[model samples]
Target: MEKEIYSLRSQFEIGLVTDTLVMLLDRGARVPLIADMPQVIPMLRGLLEGGLRHRHVYCRDTDGVYTEVVVFKERYDLELIESASQIRHFNRVLAKDSTL
Candidate 1:
């Protein structure tokens, strides 16, 4: 068994922030546990920006409260493990319209 990893990208659209998480097919049914997922809303953008792997990304929820379950990383200890987070964080956080 191995630790499964999930990554995502997000961006702001109009006035609301949209996010998307990508789970590789290779992970199979071993997806990481996401207890009470409905409450975590920062997504990859704020998560990676606020330190996705180094420390728990804390952000104010819809009610203006903070939580430590923003983004958690798993099985990411390959190389430059400390830097993998930033490497994944890129400029394209929001999905673009193909017609545009």
Candidate 2:
């Protein structure tokens, strides 16, 4: 019998950050074996503490629509740059009419 390979797609991806760790949830499973990236923990912490902002852009296609989260680091000079090791996507987006 030939074994069939299957690919699982996660409906949602969640990140939980602490002072020392970042955890992810996908496909109803907890993924705890993430690589030890030094900046990720602190950046996530900053984001939780309101020191960072997450921006979203939505794109429409013939099939449907998808959202993109803009991730970048801004320097003191206000120039935005991408970090090679930074996370490329966040699961949540702030609504434009949100009161928070």
Question: Which residue ranges in model 2 land beyond 4 Å of their true spot?
Answer: 1-12, 15-23, 26-33, 50-100
Clashes of each: 4, 0
- Tens digit of per-residue lDDT, candidate 1, span 51-96: 2334433222222222234343432211111343442342122113
lDDT score, candidate 2, position 27: 28
How does model 2 score by TM-score? 0.20
Best by TM-score: 1
lDDT (tens digit, per residue) of candidate 2 on 1-100: 2222211331222233334333333223232212212333344446455533442212211222232223355321111224333223322321211223
**How much is 9 displaced in model 1, in angstroms?**
14
